[model samples]
Structures are given as structure tokens and as C-alpha cells.
Target: MKNLFTAIFILLLIVSCLSQSTIQYIYNPPENIKDGLDVGTLAEVNIDSSLIIKAVNKIYGGRYKEVHSMLIFKDNKLVFEEYFSGHKYKWDGDNHYGELVTWDRNMPHHIMSATKSISSACIGIAIEKGFIESVHQSIFDYLPEYQHLNSDGKDKITIEHLLTMTSGLEWDEWGAPLSSSNNDLVGLWVHCEDPINCILERPLLDDPGTSYTYSGGNMVVLGEIIRTATKMKIDEFSKKYLFEPLGVDSSTWAQKFDNGVIYAGGGLIITPRDMVKFGVTFLNNGDWNGKQIISEQWVEKCTTEYRNNKGINIPGQASGRHGYSYSWWLKSYPKSGKKIDMFNAGGWGGQEIMIIPELNTVVVFTGGNYLSDVRVFNILEEYILPAIN
Candidate 1:
């Protein structure tokens, strides 16, 4: 009996140690600041002095109450950073809606559609390294298992269409419990014996690349493409190529797939700081600490406006003006009596990486407003933008 008790105690100790080790692996922070700049507390430059106070007041006035995290970087320096109420250090439980409910500053938040932008970055890197032949290559080439898709126009789908949200696949962007196509995809991903085959069975709604349709299915297909091209899982590829180099370590950086295939569309969960690092990498034109993570050509192409759907009514629109790039949103900011070039990687529920190249600025926000007021953009335009200048 004594020997058995000792053995059980040793096994318990081993299990405890393993659990702690896994947690440490997931949430490890950088040993030190990479640039030696505390991005949370950099001084703001007064580009337009008049707009400064007004912008600060607007943000502080509780207009965007659900905005939990905000960070600003200007001229390659950290400017302003803050965390608000409804924010916690980590998500502890799933909400009644079945969404994860962590809000900690150090905890990785659900980036929502911002995952699309990050996934695009992975594709860019793959193309740069010759892992992917070209963006023009048909996605079916990578996932030949999908080549048997019988839906008309499905064979014509290419990487370009998937990246640009122009595959014309019958999918709904909004994950309404009753109406969203994404919910169906999620169900299929969870239950299907062959997930890629299930996704390939989605019907094509229109001619590929001719019309734009926001579809998470498009990104899911891209995830499969990445899997085929690298001959490795997406999570492993991101950790080796993107996250580790950028000094981002997240415990929740995983896909829910059985094979741990990282969802290229929206499965990543990264902290606000890590998300800022991603923005800075892009703001630096894909260079991380003098290493070119992605080519400048790809960055320009990914951020530049590729499609214009006039008067399209989408969420996060200011005056209903919006444009789409390769997994990025293009917005023209009016400053100093001129329209400045700005683009953002935005996610549902107020997650954003707003970049203004002319001003050399980037603003990031992460929030829990999954089904709240859609006024964050107004707060950004009216308050955040003005404060930075």
C-alpha cells in the first residue's frame, strides 16, 4: 500500500508539471522588448495641435465603452495604449452564446476576421519563399482532394479569389445562429469525418473572381491550401515563420480541427501586444528586426485597393465608404486637407489594426462588442485618428 501511494503521488506530480509546462508554452512573453520601446506609453506627436485634446476627450468620454484595448504607434514609436472596463487578463469561460469569454490584456483575444489578414500574410510568405507557386495558382491544385468539387465554377477558384473574398462561394460572413453559413461550416468542421471534403462541397454562387463575396469558406479552403503547400499544419507554420520571429507566443494559438490544422480564416487567438507587433511588422513593410519576413511587393499588393464595390453597406463603415484589398480594408483618411492612404485589418467586435502610412501611424483595438453598437469606427475616426495627429 505504501509503494502504491508513492507511485500515485509521482504520477500526479508528473501530470501537474505537464499541465504547467503547457500553459507556459502557450502564454510565454518575450524575454525583453525587441525595439526597447515601450509601445504602451510613447509620447504622441502633435501633428495637428487642434485635434489633440478633442480626440483624447472623445475616447475617454465612454463613447466606446466596450473597447477594452487600444494601442497607437506613430513614426515607428509607441504613442498611446490603454485598457478599459469589460476587460480582463484572460478569458475564463464560454458565454451563453458559446463564445469564449476572456478579456485579459495579457490573454489572447478572438481576433475574428482579423485572422483573414494574418492568414493572407502567411500566404504571402509562402509565395515569397516559393512554397506556393503563385497567387494565380488554382486552390484545387494544392488540395487535389477538392478537385472533385462538382459545383459549377468551383474548379475556377484560385488563390487570388480566396484571398480577395471573390470566390463567390455561397457563404454568409455574419455568424448569426439562424442564418450564418459560417455556423454551418463550423458544424461541418466539428462533425465531418473529412472536413476538407465537406468544405469543397459548398456550392459556388457566382463566377469566381468576377464578384466579391465575403466568405469564411474561402479562407477555410486557403487553410487547406497552406496545409498542402507546406506539408505541415498551419499552427506549426505560423509558430516557426511568423509568431516566433515576431516574438508572439500565445497559449491559444491553435485551430479546433482534429489534426490541429490552424484555421486560416479565424482560429488564432493572440494578445493585444502581439497583434500590435504584427501591425508594426506590416507598418515596417513586413520587416521584423531587419529581417524581411514578407517582401515589400507583397505587402503593397496585399494592402493596396484591389476591389471597389460602390456603396456597399458593411459593418464598420464611416459614411458607408469602404474598400477591400487582399484580406485588408482600405480607407482614405482626410487629413490636412488631403486624403491620406490608410488601410486596416479589422475583425468583428471591434478588433482592429488601423494603419496610416502617410502619417506613419498604426492603431490597434481589441474589444468584446460582438453584438453591441457599431460605433467603434466613429470613435476611431472622430477620436482616435485626431488624437494621434
Candidate 2:
């Protein structure tokens, strides 16, 4: 018995040591910009080295293991970048099983629903270029073909309602598990013939702009509106205005078409570095370096709390308290007893693009923990935020 106990103890020790080593792995970013944004060390950006190491250790040890990559930008330079290897196909109920996936600085990582935020940016650009009239314009105005579907308060829906997620469409993406047959998003993807028409035909649960309903379908409608107004496919339009201007050519969007109309609700895949570039552009108030890709007013309108949705709780969030603003999720992080306002472009399977305007920091995290509790935000609160001096 004694010998057996000793053997067991030794095995545990070995496992613990191996885990520690993995956690201790350091990510050294480039010393200078060769083709993209400038890079620097964590310490150079006022982040504590020991604290960040400890944070990475927790991430490597905990359920955060699915994290593919994490990037931090502060003081206008890339500070920290880390990537991991995990399963690429992590759907909870789907039969699609993929091989092992390893991410690096160059590879594009799936951002899932974070694409909604990107879609919002596309709308901002469309508005700037006068392709779309304004957020106040009725959505039916853009889709005259779908005007026949409009009735009984549906015509009251505006572009702003779609962006703020207050279209009051009867979407249950949050209320039901993604694996459930009743999940509205899954139902739309699997069964709906015309996603835009299906969403527009949804009976209004409440008047437009009266209540907040977390719906990806609203973005689908907005995407079509952008396409109609600009007369360009979303991929082509985004490439010419957004991606090409940012010098990002490696990104891909999973655009689907039904009867010649495009759906841009989600499935935007890009590198963690490129995601940070998008966040930094918002941090710079719609300016990409010198050019105003999106107007400053659009940036403010989207990030700010346009309407309060405190009662609607996100499924896996422990806090269960979040606000919505133009496809972005708004939350206040308690850093050293101070409430730091943070906005993020979040997605299914743990993808996040968080921006802290007060700290002038942008953080990008990609993972494969689909439909599971993502504790990445806690790591940010416990390690990243505290490390900032």
C-alpha cells in the first residue's frame, strides 16, 4: 500500500510539473513592423511581466486551454501575442469533426459572431459613402422586394433597431441552447429558405426599439441592406473599403447566398493581429492611421450605450449583466474597485475583440470552447487589468 501511494504521488507530481512548463511558455512578438502594426514587449507597454506570466499559467492550466490566440495592444503598439493548438471543429451537437488546429500570428482564426460587429462597421462605411442613407431609414426602404412581407409594426423597424438589436424579432438564440432543435439561429441555418425574408416575417414580440432581443438575424437584414444600397457583394465591398485599407488580405468571410441575396450575419475569419487592428481603429475613433475609414460619429454611436438591456442575460456569462450597442456588447469591468467601461466584438466559441478606451488598449482572443463557459474575461480582470499600472 505504501509503495502504491508513493507511485501515485510521483505521477501527480509529474503531471503538475508538465502543466507548469506549458504555462511558463513565453510569447515573444516581433521587435519591429515588417508588414503590419508595430510590436513590443509586455513590459514596454506597461504590463507587468510576472503578472502576465502568472495569467498565462492560469490560462494554460484551466478550461481556457481552448484559447487559440490572444493579443494585446497598448500605447499604439502590439505588446503580447500567444497562440495554442486545439480542435478546429468544436461544435457541440454537429457531426463535423476536424483535425487538430494550431494558430500563429499569420493564420486566420474563426471569429464566429464577432462578424456581426464587423458587419456593423461595414454599415458605418456604407453610410459614410452615402450608399445607405442613415440608421434612421426604415429597413424596408432598402429591401423593396421584401416590402411585401412588412406589416403590423415590421415597417417600423429601422437600421438603428437592427444595429442595437432592438428589432424585437422573436429570436431565441440566447434563450435556447445552440444544440437544441428549437435554437432559432440553428433553425434558420438549417431550414429557412430565405433567411432575410424569414427574419423579416417574424412576428414582432414588441414594438421596434422598445425591447432588446439578441438576434443575429437582424445583422443578416442589415447586410442585405448594405449590399442593395452599395450594389456590391459584402466580400467585395469589405475588401475594397475595410480589409484592403487595413492592409489585411488573408481574411475570409463565410458569405452565403439565397436567391442572389447575401447573408453576413456571422462566420468572419481573420488573424488575431487583424482583429486587433480593427479594435485599434475603433480606439482611434474611426481613423485607420490617417484615413477616416468610418466617421467619428459612427464610432461613438455604435460603442456608446444607445439603449439599456440589463434584463437580458447571456447564457454562459456569470455576471449575466451586459448592455448592447450597435452589435457590440458593453460591460463594466471592476479593476481595482473601479468600473472600467469596456466594449467588445464577441462571438460563439470564445472569440473576442475587447477595447478599453480609457486605457487605450485592445485585446483579441480566439478559442474553440463552443457553447461552453468562457472564462477569458475573468483572466482579463484578474491578470491583464491588474497588470496595467
Candidate 3:
């Protein structure tokens, strides 16, 4: 009987040691004064550090390859930040390629279609500054140069329609891979002589705001409108109104093949740390550090749309079809058998900024999963969300 008691004591001691080992480790990201983001330990935000460590281990363990960076902001403080070495997306005329590179806090990563969200913010800023009147204004009001193409209800397209991607332009971007010349988005920047004219000349498939479609052409048109109304280039406008105010570390926007026109649809290249700030701004109802970046009205409108009307199927968006917002993808994450309200600005090759208003959290990721399956959503659903305390 004494020997049995001794064996039981030994088992208890082993289990206690295992439990202690699991909870003993914690990760605290370093603070950078220049970054302008307040830093705090994950414990302060009631996040499970062990889960984050497990997620990082899976990343470094090669379970989720081609991931470059990950960051988490909870309660307006950056609680976790991490970077990894992965492939970066590079492009030729129509072909997309990749190169293995080391990622860091300062490397500016191309955000692809995520630039549309920033462009949406630009539109809100333009309205706040009285560049144009409102989103109800016709696109032709700013693009009178393309007034010739206004026949057959094309002239009826409004800025709001463009923001919601209901412009009704017959654009074929998702029909083929971007590397194929058949993709209209690739042709607009590469083969077409004039992007604005090329997109504007497309036939109107439906009356504006009647159907849902995902096209980068809508964002390009909005960029032109911003330029026309603000009397400045998209890059300059963003720096002055968006990036500068948000304190972005560094950024670059790619231009047209042979012109100065910026591809506001997918041109932004910024560090992952800087990229998440935009989501934070939206989470705070268009306010950043006590300054009203965009009005609260825009924020509410940006997230109001919750219908996945057309059964949009996007790679890396395997949480089923997501609803469209003003350049934002409205989604709900399933947690504890209930869906949590969430939204994101996702781009090709795994660049993403996901915000959960219910949790008051923002998650950022940058990767090079071009033309391939991505592990981003899996990481979020499995590791990140479960880490919340």
C-alpha cells in the first residue's frame, strides 16, 4: 500500500511539472519609439501566450510556409509582433514570380488588392476635405474626359457604386490567373495604352449598384477621381492625408507600365507594422490617436454590407464566400459555435489586415503565397482566435 502511494505521488509531480512548463514561457515584443505604436505584453491584453508561441512554432516549423510577418493589436496596443524569412512576390509584364527573402519590421511588402481599402480611405478623406460633394456624385462628374463612353447607363455609375464594387463594368479579372494575358486587371496596367479609357470603355453589364462583382478596375477609376478632385497624384494624396497622419514608416506604390498613373487597385507596398494601423483606424471608427481621419459615417457605411450576393469564391478566403463592403470584405469568424463580426482587407499572396470588432483586435499578415494555397485563414481560426483569453 505504501508503494502504491509513492507511485501516485510520482505521477502527480510529473503532471505538475508539465503544466508549469506550459505556462512558464511568455513572449513580449520589443517597443520602438519611432514606430508610434504603444507596446504591451500579451498578458496585459489577456491573450494566451502559449497559443501564440504554438502558432509561431508552427510557422517556424514549416507548417505554414511563405508567411512573412504577423502582428496583433489588442485594446489599441501592439501586443505581439513577429517576422519570418519567406518568399516575396515579384512581377514581370503579366507573370508573377517569387524570391526568397528575409522579412523584418521595416521591409515594405506589396499589399496587392489591399490597396483598394486604402483607396477607399482616400475617398473618405477627399469627401471630408470637400474634394467632391459626396459618394452619390457621378463618376463622370470627375471624369468628364470619358464622357463619350457614358451611353447605355454607364454615366449613372456613382462613387458609392465604385466603393462597393457595383460599378457594373464588364471587367474580367478573376476569370484567369493574373499571369495570363487574358486577365483584364493585368492587361490594364501592362498591355492597354490607357487604363482609364480601357476600363471606362467596357460595356455596362448591369445597371449600377444592382449586382455584386469584384474587380480592381473600380478602384482604378476611384483613384482617377481622387486625382481629379484633389488636384494631386494618388501617392501624394495618400502621404499627406493617410500615411503621414498614421505615421507609416515607409511605403511605395507601383506605377503604370509606361505612365505615371498609380495602380491604386493593388500598388501599395508598406511594412506589416504600418499596414495594421489602417485596420486600427477603421476599428476606432475612422479615428487615429484622437484625430478624426475619416468620419464615423464612412466607417459605418464601410461595414454595413453583409450580403454575399454572387457567391464570390476567392483563394485564401475558404471561410466560405464573404460579403463585400466599401473595399472591405465582411466576414464572421466561427468561435464557440457563434460567429464573431469581422472584416478584412486582403490581397493576393497573403497580404491581409483582419479586424474583429467584437474582440477589439486587429491581426496583420504579409506573405508570398502567390497563385498557391494560403495558410492564413487556418492560422487565424486555429491559433490566433483561440489565443484570446
Candidate 4:
């Protein structure tokens, strides 16, 4: 009987050790402070590790099964980084198929429409450096190729309208499934020869800047403006000002180009770790270490909730109401009173770079569940935030 009790005690001890959680990090300390993220313990960062472990298990075991990677940073140090194997949709000759892929610490994942936020940042930098005058300046002034369309209500469109997605062009990207031919962005991509010309040629559905209308054409136009302003491609400009400054030069950043114009609406591929650096830079008010990669004023304007469109039911947005900023998505957590202020760069298939200034935390996600991207909010609320002390 005593030996039986001793065996049970040994089993319990093994279970206890197996259930214990620790922060598993992948970054190596570089000689340059700007080259890598600092690492810390969940306890030291004031986070509950056991709870975080449960969150990671939920991501991999069943819940959020489509998540490719999940990362969290607090106090400017990486606390949790986890990757999962999943399948990505790709074209195979005549049809699309799910290609099995393994996500790790170093692989670059597609960010989809999150590229819009990065493109907006480039425009802000261009404005600060005097490459572009201001967001209020007419977009037509820069694109003489579309000067013919400036006669009607299109004449009222400005750079701010494009950034805010209030340009009110006849767009139907959010109105239909991406696989459907009716989706405007997909149509523009597949059928149009020049996406910029395709967007500019469309008649205005509403007066510019009066109401909200999510348009990829707005982003395509911005990409051209950046090229004209900086006299360089989007990739080149980002390398010089954004990626290199943050020590993300090793990353594989893929940008789409049609007829020499980068597809600014989407098609940016970056690693989950580098995405966290971006969130941290914005959390630190656009400063990376000691260098100002993006101006503080631009960060504030982009993150600020410029328009509150709550209670409006938008298709695919499970959360009924959300505010819009320059190119960032804004929504409060808990969906109730005394909410936690949060802003994110969200993309199709659940790519996110979430920033919560109140908690000094940045959460990054790369997912492949295109139909249910909003489900990540549940993971954030039920698991991630609860893991915080």
C-alpha cells in the first residue's frame, strides 16, 4: 500500500512539471539594439504564463485552428511566440488549392489588406519629408494621367479622402466573397490592365469625404501618388525608411506590381516577428529605439478614431460597430462600457497587428481562416487578455 501511494505521488509530480508554462522565445540578441526584440519572463512582464499556455493550446489544439502564428509583447519585450502548421490557398494552373505549409519564426506570411496601413505610413513619411505637400492636396494634381476625370465630383477627391476610405468610389470589395466575380477588388485585379487607371476612371458614387466606403482602389491610387512623390518604388522607399530602421532588413517583403505600379491595396509578405516591431513602433509613438521611423503626429492621426460608425451592420464584420482611422481599424474591447481602447491593422484571413496602449502590449497574428477573421477577437478576449494580470 505504501508503494502504491509512492507511485501516485510520482505521477502527480510529473503532471505538475508538464503543466508548468514558460516563455519560449526565438529572437537572438544582436550587437545593435535596433536589430532584435528584448526577451522577458511572463511573470516579470506581469502576465500569467499558465493562462498564456492555455491560450497557445487553444490556438493549436482546436479553437482558432487556422491561426498560423501568435505573438505577444509587453514592456517592449517578447513574452509569447508560437507558430502552427496550416494550409494556404494558392493557384494551381487552372484552379485554387490549399497548399499545406508550416509556419515558423522566420517565414514571411501574406498580410493581405494590412498592406494598406503600411502604404499609408509611407505617404505620411513622404509628407513629412516634403515629397508630398499635404493630405488635403488634390490627388489629381499629382496624377496628370487622370486629369480628365477631375471635371465632375471626382475633382473634390483629396489624399485624405483616399486614406480615410471616404473617397466614395463605386466599390464592392466588402459586399461580396473574394471568390465571386462580383467583388470589385478581385475584378479590378483580374480584368483591369492598369488598376490605378481602373479606379480613377470609375464615377464617384458619393461626394468625397462625406461617408465611409471601404475601397481598395483608394489604396491603389495612393501607391501611385507615393511613386510620383518619392520618385522611387514603394518597396525601395519602405526599405530605406521603415524596414532598415527597425532592423527588419532580413525579412522577405513581397509587394505586387501591375504595369510597374505596386499593388498598395494588399500583397505584402512579412514575418510575424517583424510585424510586432511595427506594432511596438506605433505603441512607442513612432520611435524605434532612438530613431523616429514615423512621425508621432502621423501615428496619432492614423490611430485616432476619426469616425464612429457603431450600430451599423456591415457584412463580415461580426462586431456591429467599428470606427475608421487613416488606414487602421479601430474598435473597443469587451463590446461594452469601460472598454479597453484597442487599434489594429487587420487583413483578410486573420492577419493582425493589435496594439493596446493601456496595457503596453502588442499582439500579432497570422491566420488563414478567410471566412471568419473576426473570431480572433474571441481569442483575444477570452484567452489573451485574461492571461494578463
Candidate 5:
């Protein structure tokens, strides 16, 4: 009995050590980039390095059971970049029962709601190129079928309202059948033959711009609006204006249904490295490698909190320690009783692109937490943030 106990204890120790090593492996900066540029030389930001390491360790030890990647950049140089799991690109097509998946630098994973941020960027580009008239323009102007609806108050809805998630259109963001009636806009993407028509048909639950409701329906509507205004498919416009410029050419955009439109709210697949590039672009204020991809004005407007959802001053809200800006989330914390501005692009599961503009820093994290786990955020706040310090 004593020998058996000793063997079991040794086994547990080995498992624990292996787990710790895995965490370190994922957080390690990419070797090629590290050799080319020193992360320490990137910029001057006061971060506790030990805290950052602890944060990374905690996240990896948590319940997220999929590939994870992160990158931190300050100034114009790469500070940190790394990947975990031999499974870099874990898609529906790649995962089969008991198959040993090997993922590396080039593997692409589904980004989920992070796509909303990218879609928002596309809209900003359209606005800068004169395709979109203004944020105040009536949405019906782009989708004329919406004009037939007896939506008197709805007509007052503007592009800004939708971008800020204050459109007041009824929507249940949480995918609960019991909660479906809270927002009549549920299943618009999956059920409707015409997404634009489905969105226009939703009944107004409150006056436009009066409340805050997180709506995937709103994002689908924005995608339709971009398609109409630009007279191009969402995927094409994204490629020409956003992806190609960033040198990210391998990502795939999945549609909700066969012969249907791309799922603009969440269904984008991209590499972890490419995801970092997207965050870095925002950190650089919409420029990439010396070229202006998105207008500086658009970046400012989209990142700043545009409306007060209910009583919540979005940027001042405590939920996720962030505020809603267009499709981005503005994360801030009170330092000495004053709110400091930080922002992030987040997705369902554990995908995040956190930016601290004051520090000229950007961090990206991706994982598959889904509904089975909620510890990923805890890891971010308690472990990841401390490690960067």
C-alpha cells in the first residue's frame, strides 16, 4: 500500500510539472521574431514581468481545452508572440476522434465574435472611402425594403445606434430558448432567407438609442449594410480593404447557410499571429507598416463610447471592466478614482484582443472555452495582466 501511494504521488507530480511547462511553452515569445527584434526595446511601459508570467500560467492551467495564442506589442516592435498545442488550427474539418493534431505557426482557428471587430473595421473603411454617407444616415436608406415597415420610431434609428448597440431593437444575445422572446430578432441569420429583410422586420422594443442590448442581429444588419453600400460582397470588401493590406491572406469566412451570406457577427477563421496583427493595427491608430488602412477619424469615433446604454456609461461600466464602442469593448479600471481608457475586441469562448493605448500596448488571446467554462476571464484578470507588469 505504501509503494502504491508513492507511485501515485509521483504520477501527480509529473502531471503538474508537465502542465507548468506547457504554460511556459505557450507564453514564450516566438523565436524568429525575438531574434529579429528585442521585446524589451519596443517601448517603455511599466508592467510587472513576473505578474505577466503568472497570468499566463494560470490561464493555461484553467479549463480552456483548445489551442491558445497571444501576442504583446509596444511601440512598433513585437514584444511577445507564442502558440500552444500541437493543434494550431483546430477546425471542424481537422478534429476527428483520437487523432493527434499538430498545429504550428501557420494554423488558422475560428475567431468567433472577434469577426465583429473586423467587420466594424470594414465599415469604417467604407465610410472613409465615401461609400457610407454618415453614421446618422438612416439604415433604411441602404436597405429600401425596410421602408415598408410601419416603424415610425424605427425610422429614427441611425448607423451610430446600431454600431453602439443602442438600436433598441429587441434581441436576446444569450442563446437560450427561454430568453428568445426577450428579443424578437433571434435566429435572423439562420431562419431568414433575406437577412436584411429579417432585421427590418423586428419590432421596436424601446425607442432607438435608449437601451443597451448585445445583439448578433445588429452585426448581421451591419454586414448587409456594408454589402449594399459598397456594392460588393462582405468577404471581397474585407479582403481588398482590410486583410490584404495587413498581409493576412489565408483566413476563411464561413457563411451561415449554403448559398447564404457570411456570418459577420462571429464566423471568421484566422491565425493567432494574424489576430495579433489586427490588434497591432488598432494600436498604431489604423496604420500598418506606414500605410493608412483605416482613417484615423474613423478609428477615434469607433473606439470612443458613443452612447450611454441605459444608465451605464459604457467606458465607465464595470461589466468586463469595459465599455462598448462600435463593435469594440473599451476596458478601463479606476486608478486613484479616475477611469483610464483601455480597449479590447472580444469573442465568445476566450478570444480577445486587448489594447492599452496609454501604454501603446496590444495583447491577443484565443481559446475554446465556450459555455462549458468561464474561468478564462479570471485567468486574464488575475494571471495574464499581472505577468505583463
Candidate 6:
């Protein structure tokens, strides 16, 4: 019994030591770009390095399985950055299970529904540039091509309804996994030659703007609106107006599309570093460096939660419920006994870009923990916030 106990203890010690070396790097992140971001040490930023290290250890120890990369920007400096190995996939049309590959900082991870937030930005830009009329305008005004879909109360649906996911269209994106044919998203992806028109054809189960239903179809319509208004696809429109202004490399960001039409709802591939640039832009009130890429008013309108209680209660979030804005997510965390609101662009399988306006912080994460149930919010609440507290 004594010998068995000793062997067990030794095995545990070995596991612990191995976990400690999971992310073998110093906290002093390198200054990769002179004009892009300034790098600094954790002490320079006044964060408790020990706490951050503990969190990373836990992630590597399988507490947060399959995290690919984490980058934190605070006080105008990139302070802590880390990467880990994990399995992730690329979607190839109807396969559902696309090419599986190991994730790394060099490899761009699919941002999933976070694409909706980017699509939202494109909509805002279009409004400012006169490519789009107004969020209050009937969506059919922009989509004249799909004018036949206007019957059955669908004509009353405004761009605002789609933005808030309150279009009152019957959608089953939340009930089943995307892999199941029963899921509405799968049906939207598979069934039609004209996917946007198919979404419009969905039965209006409730009065427009009266009910909140999570639907990717809403985004598809928005993307098509941009495409219709401008003579370019949504991806091309965003490239010229949004991406280039922010100094994001063209090669680093790509939108997934069917043939030539970008969905703008769930398919975007971006590096974690580039993701932080977006968070900074929104946090800084639509300004990138000096240029106003998006209107300040639009930024406020999009990020602000609608008055009508159309929010979602996240499963593992300690905050309980989160509000939905024009594609952005709104939640508040208790920090040092004060409420700190968070603006976020979140995606399926753990991709996120989180902005703490109060803290002057932006955190970016990319992972493929679709089924793990390990939330970045839990990590933020327990370790990240407390370190700076």
C-alpha cells in the first residue's frame, strides 16, 4: 500500500510539471510592428503576472480545453500574448466537417458568428457612405430583387429588426447543432439556390420587432443588402472601406461564400492580432488611429442594447444574461465593486473579441472548443479581472 501511494504521488507530480511547461514563454511580448501596436511587460501594465500564469496553466491542464490563442491589450499597449496547440477545422461547403488542422498563431482561425459583428460594421459604413438608406427603412427597399418575399408581414421588417435578431421569423439555430439537418442554419446553408430569398420566405411567426429569434438568415439579408447597394460583394465592399482603413492586411482576412456571395453571418477567418485592432476601433468610438472609419453615432447605435429586453442568457457566464445590440454583444461584469460593461464580438466554438470600455482593455481569443463548455467569461471573471483588481 505504501509503495502504491508513492507511485501515485510521483505520477501526479510529473503531470503537474508537464502542465507548467505547456506555454513555455516569457510574459514580455515582443514588439512585432512599430506602427501597429506597442508591446510591454506585465509589470509595465500593472497586472499580476502570477494570476495570469495560473490561468494559462489551468487552460493547458485541460480546464479550458482547445484554446488556440489569447491576446490582451490594455492602456494602449499589448501586454500579454500566448498561443497553444489545438485541433480546428475549415468548412468546405456541405461537408460540415471540413479539413481538420492544428491551430496556431500563424494559422487564421474561423471567427464563426463573429462575422455578424464585422458584417454589422459594413452596414454602418454603408449607411454613412450613402450606400444604404437607413436601419428603419423596409429591408425590401434595398432588396428590390427579392420584392416577391414582401408578402405575409415581411414587408414591415426593418434593418433594425434583423440587427437585433427580433425579426419574429421562426428559426431553430439554438435548439440543435449546426451539423443536424433539422437546424435552421443547416437548411439555410443547404436547401436553396438563393439562400437570402429562402430566409425571406420563412414564415413570420410574430409581429416584426416584437420577438427576438437568433437567426443567421438575418445577417445573410444584411450582407446581401450591402452587395445590392454597392456594386461589389460584401467582402469586397468591406475590404475597400473598412479593412484597408484599419491597416489590416488583405491576405489575413477572408470571408466564406457560396460561389461568389458572402454570407456575412458565420464565416470569417482572421488572426487574433487583427481581431484586437477591431476591438480597439469600436472601443475608441469608430476611430482607427486618426481617421473615422465608421461614424461615431453608428458605433453608439450598434453597441447600445435595444430597450426591449431582447438579450440572451449565456450558459456558463457568471453575469447571467447578455444584451444583443446591432450584432455586438453587451454584458456587464462586477469589478472592484463597480459594474464594468463589456462590448463583445463573439462566435461559435469560443472565438471572441471583448472590449472593456471602463478598463481601456481589449481581449482577443480564438479556439475550437465547440463542445467543451469552457467559457472565456469564466476565465475573465476568475483570473483576468482579479489580477488587475
Q: List clash counts for every candidate, in order.
A: 6, 0, 0, 0, 14, 0
| Model 6 residue 377 distance off true place after TM-score fit, in angstroms | 0.8
lDDT at residue 166 of model 2 (Cα atoms): 90
| Prediction 4 global C-alpha lDDT | 0.79
Over 4 Å off in model 4, which ranges? 1-34, 91-97, 250-257, 308-317, 334-337, 372-374
- Consecutive 10-residue window with the lowest summed lDDT within model 6: 90-99
Alpha-carbon runs more than 4 Å astray in model 6: 1-25, 90-104, 250-259, 315-319
Measure candidate 4: CA RMSD: 6.2
TM-scores, in order shown? 0.80, 0.92, 0.90, 0.87, 0.81, 0.90
CA RMSD for every model?
A: 12.6, 2.6, 7.4, 6.2, 4.7, 3.4
> Judged by lDDT against the true structure, how good is candidate 6?
0.80
Clashing pairs for model 2 are: none
Of 1 and 5, which scores higher on lDDT?
Answer: 1
RMSD of 2: 2.6
Task: Say which prediction, candidate 4 or candidate 5, comes out ahead on lDDT.
Answer: 4
Please tell me which predicted candidate would have the highest lDDT against the true structure. 3
Clash number for candidate 6: 0
Q: Candidate 1, TM-score vs. the true structure?
A: 0.80
lDDT of 2 at 127: 88
Location of the lowest summed lDDT over 10 successive residues in candidate 1: 23-32
Q: Write the per-residue lDDT of candidate 1 for residues 1-389, one digit (tens) a residue.
A: 99999999999999997775444111122223553334433333553434433443444455565677766677756656556556432223332134334345566777877888888988998888889999998777898665668457676878988888888777664445412334665565656666667667777777877787677767777877888999866777778888888877772545566755556777578988788778888888998778888789889987776755333456543435777888888778775688877778887667888888777787888876654554666766676666654
lDDT of 6 by residue, 1-389 (tens): 99999999999999988787665545656466664777787787788988888888787777887678888888888888888877666443333335545555556678888888998999999989998879999899988888888899888999989988988887888787767668888776577677877788889999998877788889988888888888788778888998888777632335444655577787677778778888888888999888899899988986799767445875433346788888888888888878988988888778899999888888888877665574777888888988874
lDDT of each: 0.69, 0.82, 0.84, 0.79, 0.68, 0.80
Q: RMSD to the native, candidate 1?
A: 12.6
Q: List the residue pairs that clash in candidate 1.
A: 26-251, 88-103, 88-104, 89-104, 90-104, 91-102
Clashing pairs in 6: none
